[model samples]
Target: MILDSSLNITLDNSNNAVFRILGEERFKITNAGPDIGGRLQFSNGRYIHASVQDDPDVDELRFKASGHLDEPLRIYGGSNYNKRVGIGRLSESPSRPNEDMSRFGLDLQDTGNGYLYGLRLTNDTTGTGGSNGACIYYENSNMYVRNFTGGPIKFKTKGAQAMVIASNGCIGIGGITNPMYTLQLGFVNSNSGGAQRHANWNYLNSSNNSFKQLNGNYGNISIFVGGHISINGVIVCVSDKRTKTNIYPMNPVKSLDNLRLLNPVHYYYKDFINNPSQLQAGFIAQETKHVLPTSLEMAGQSIPNILASASYYVDSFKNKIIQFSDFDTSKLELDNSGNFYPYLRVFDEENDIELPYWITISKILSSNSIQIETKEELPSRVFVYGQYVDNFHLLHYHRVFTTFVASMKEVDAELQKEKLKTLELQREMNELISLVQTIQK
Candidate 1:
């Protein structure tokens, strides 16, 4: 029984009017209205109850009811709200549609019962529920609507009870709509609760955008006033997207336009200047300087100036080691009287690196013999180029040695001992020659 788009039928007379031919069985209307009204055409079809096809793909039944032949035709399932009495009169709001459309509308049976429905869209736009009404609402086991232009579907509940509104079994807005019962969206259990949640990829990255509806997963995911975002909610992502999951944010942080609204710094601004009460005690560290990030980028960071200065000094030390071959062994000699330091210099023809202009040894005793209690050596150039670290003005202690000459009038004790050793060695040689002459005789 292959039925393409070309199949057509007509019902003009009363008894044999409007017959639907299935595979082998032919179905005719058991009941009809008056003469002209009873007519049923394939294009303008009217049936007691349409036999909707069963399709798991669409989540609906196979046989179902069609609409009346009036100007604005409509269809409903076994749970049609048309027969149900309205709780109150449907009202209209000038600004936007009320969230409690069902309050002025139909009420389903007690829990443990539901219904199903099917709606095939042929033209660009169509309307159902009532011809001219405001808060028309319906509830069913499953509702399927497709093959139509893009016009948002609206559903309003009567009370703010914990009810779930869903799209395609998903609490998200946009994307493929699902047909299922127990569908819920955000949590607005009393005062006008709604969510414009958009699985719409374009709007997902933007703040203040929401998915308007949910298909299912009520207790699983709910959005409401004063509700904090869950730690790790369900990820809404497409198969084709690079990141197949939407658990974490894929976009950068600066996308936030109203960051102050979310996380405000000042509870209330204190005085203009120096107010002890205004300053937060815990936040002692102030933000010195920060590169304000753009609307959609992370804040950039620069090298700290203080740290850069320190690095410059360290690199200089390394370069000195490389330039001076003996810099590793050369020690620094500092004097306590004037805080003068004499450092070793490499005046080799190959390298002309300056030692500390003034070499003053202090504090530590060396391995040398006449343990001088304290030794201080100042470089003549100390007045010219100062030391490696300069907290104050530069020093050139090494320059003082250029015009100064050492007076050997009071020679060092170590030098006196070496001269005595030379004289003793001369006497020993003379005695040895005398012994050799006696042997010849």
Candidate 2:
């Protein structure tokens, strides 16, 4: 029978009192204290129970959703004030409360171990029947939270929007605008106040140390780092001549002399003991430091500005090749000294008659016949080949040309001095002849 009014059973006469509901089972209580115990059957199979005990070794109170002993699962939420609830498989009715809470805040146990889930929402339905109905739905073991209507899921901090999952499912931080990519970190005032000019990403180590920073400071993007940087396992640096100023030419004689003083050794690094046969030819860093200290840094040694000048001259040679059609080959004809050099065959081994490396290599490759690209006969393939030939020859020719020009200059100075001596001897002979003529007269 449904009670329309409040029913209170006074325990004034008896220490233990029992109350019957639906005439099915009896609810008994022993003492009236902070502890309370009772059972309420809701429907045919479901029941809610609250049991309190005074014994120190027993559970103080236990609230349970109990059913048949063989029932596979049961879930019960105790009073919210107590801070614990349980949902699990229990074979027997709970005689004492399990006051343990798992790490995830739910006391879920099975024999000895069970997982505790903080929150679980499930929808048991098939096909499209549960679609467009709820935010969270479960199909067997899988669960999904879907926004059937076009709306955004926002995460906020201090009531300020921090991140947003938009209707189109793009996640955005700092701005709620739909992201163009899967994840977008937006900046406020991105188009104003120089905000767009700064680095977009930054990273720091545990010690708050920054190793590299990509910045846009001078209207160009560049990286700033503490030490030397490498790209793809190679050390590279930008050296655009146009970006440089205060340039001066190097005295090749002095540089070459300094280079010669640094003795190069054919040695292999002990670190590469496995590759002992790969011998390297280079000057030791300490030995080089004695003569060319400027080339030595903490990291390694490098060629000085001499290489830059050499590179500039190599580029000039390339320009000359590109404009070869404008060159007058007749300039190779005999000068006033009657000496003509159709091709300057620079040789090795210090043998004047020895074949030049360029000629020897050309004959070895069976490419001695040069196909020069002219303005009138500019074959694409020949132009490309000429470019490659110019680049290849320039590399080897520059060093030889340096020494050759130095030696040639010395020889030309001696020739000039000999010519002056010969003229002076002729003058002396004329003066002596005039003196003898005068004595005869």
Candidate 3:
């Protein structure tokens, strides 16, 4: 059936007209002219509203409307416009037969006014036990969610939360429910090695921060820069004494005696091209190890290695009673197998008690210069032990100052005793001269 009219024609009193081709209304102009708004026919069941002026040559479709528009104008895929499908911005006109501008996605831009988001994507399916939330899913797997307004970004797996960025900008990894730190990892198995975590940062194309943990006993956190690490910020490595074990009592006097062996010298850094002459007072690790062998180890080794071997070296001698009555250097035979370190035997003058203490040896460095030949992570090159890497200079100076103060106190006491003895001797000589004069008279 076909109908063609040149003038105003209406098939019904409801002011509706339809033109059909092949039993389908290919074109429908709903209202009268000058108020024209309806669907225009495009091939493959696609239609565009007459309210939009679309240029197919450039893939541009713009809405042309007069006066104030409604809150939102939604364009859906089907005839009812109920299901939500993303709209793509075309680079060229789709109406043109020669041009194929087919790109499917949404483009959101923010110009000003701090508009939270230009586009919001949401999936609200609540009745069938599915959560009503906003998420981005790929390959049938829900990956991430922008759940709340101005809230943390979350990563999820099958609706189970795996990670979150807190509102205060703290990041949490693993199944960590609460993230109270800058970077936190939790909910890991005690012996699992499969769930390794890493964070990488490149700063100014010069410095890099990297961390990798292969279980609790093995891991490394490295921050490096062009063969040298310069930390502009404070780095606080936790040093709670409770984490340590088998700590022996320290002898500050023995420490003072061993410290005298260190060479105080003026030197320049060989690692840098612009070398500056500096004054330094410390022992070389290899040299000091010869004198205090039990106190030193390689840079990467764990601390308190001597404690682990102490029982093997000292346990047998604990039960035996040995005494040295006289000093005879010629008859003494040293045991080469025994580990020897300095111990101070002090008699407390004020308390009248015997105090024996092992020296608190401050292990020094073998190499003070950075290795300039390589730009890789070198754990053996960088040295740190018990929070005293760059700050070892301060500890060495403190030992020097305390030793000076102790020596000054001893000198002052000796001078006072000598003055009193000299006065008494002078009085006795004067009394003897007076008796000799009386006998001569």
Candidate 4:
């Protein structure tokens, strides 16, 4: 039978109906039984258009054209309005897509508020209209995953919930259930008969910042504002011999002399102006680095000293001057010479002290003779301690323990020598008294 100019229908030998359009097979309907269900097949790139109303003008579903076989079949909703695709039970009111309908299955809805999309999953086993499930939606420039059942959203791995995002926006790891803080971690301890051992990083408020174990006897580690860290337990450092290399003994006398050069001071941090009376006792990093240069650790890469091999001498005005024949004067312009200030110090051989001074470059008097002025008079022999990398010096204060022990040993040797001198003087005085007694007799 011919229905229109492009449409044609005929029955095959097995009584299966075949439909064609423009001489091409567009669809085929099989004469299978109801139990087997009659098959309806559409050719490639063909689609079925659907409409809610019988009116020919309203097409709620439209087909998208696909040029390749691998491209997925796309269905578009009606134009100029948002639409919802619902599977299983739906709400009585089709217009209110966001209504709480205690239905089972999924609903993907577009609310038409700037292309916002919502996906809701509901499970109402009791048949009562109590919506309880999860919803993943996008609104107001943010995507939200919400669970209306007041339960946590769990991420599972290896048959166990590895992480959970609580209803109150708290996060838990290692199978934690009721997280009391913003972030919590836990573990199921087999030794404790599956007890939950956990640590909480509580930053709920500015005044209550702490990271501590909740169910165990472990102490807390708190970091307060103003760069202060309070640890309730002793700090231990790894000092295994296997981890160390190039071991050598320090010279006790030299170590003692170097340690003596470090001057301990009682001072407060510049930022801690509110507590002026609260003094901290420690050696200055710069002074300690001068005393035990080997103990200093660079924060990052060590900067090579360009003037390390340069000869240093004091000018007529007692200003220190560094002379390097191969120095690059082009890099150091006279206008910006003051910005490249170098830290200079003189080792007084006779006085046995290091006098530190800052060298301000006044002029690039040639590559070899860069005229520099010091704040104070420098000693005869000048030494360059290298320029600051980023206007700061980082020193490892903990590495000075070996030098401190060596200094103690040097002090003990001095005490031993004083004891020997006292013993010899006492014996000589005894002999002199005996000689005086013999002459009197």
Q: Note each model's CA RMSD in angstroms.
A: 34.5, 27.8, 21.6, 19.0
User: For model 1, what is the C-alpha lDDT against the true structure?
Assistant: 0.29
Q: Is candidate 2 or candidate 3 better by lDDT?
A: 2
Maximum-TM-score candidate = 4
Each model's lDDT comes to 0.29, 0.39, 0.38, 0.53
Q: After superposition, how far is residue 34 of candidate 3 from its true place, in Å?
A: 28
* Candidate 1 per-residue C-alpha lDDT over 320-426 given as tens digits, one digit per residue, 9 for 90 to 100: 11121122212332344655243322122223333323322232222220111113332212211212322212112121111111212223334677788888988
Output the TM-score of candidate 2: 0.29
**Tens-place lDDT digits, model 2, residues 87-149:** 333313332123343311222233222322223323345323123333443344765555544
TM-score of 1: 0.15
Residue-pair clashes per prediction, in order, are 63, 0, 8, 0
Off by over 4 Å in 2: 1-37, 40-47, 54-83, 87-152, 166-169, 187-228, 233-441
Candidate 4 similarity to native, TM-score: 0.37
| TM-score winner, 3 or 4 | 4
**What is candidate 3's lDDT per residue for 1-441, written digit by digit as tens?**
324463333343444444322222224333332223344433333334433324322222223223312212223332222223233222122222123222233323332433223235554444221133333322233333444445678779999998898878889877776788677776433222323344322234224455332333323343222233456656455457977799774454555455566555655444232223355345555565544555454322112111110000112523211112222212222123532221212223334433232222222112221112222222211111111121111123343545555555556667778988989989998999999999999
The TM-score-based order of candidates, best leading, equals 4, 3, 2, 1
- Residue ranges of candidate 3 with Cα displaced over 4 Å: 1-87, 90-151, 155-163, 168-260, 271-441
Model 4 misplacement above 4 A: 1-105, 108-245, 270-277, 300-394
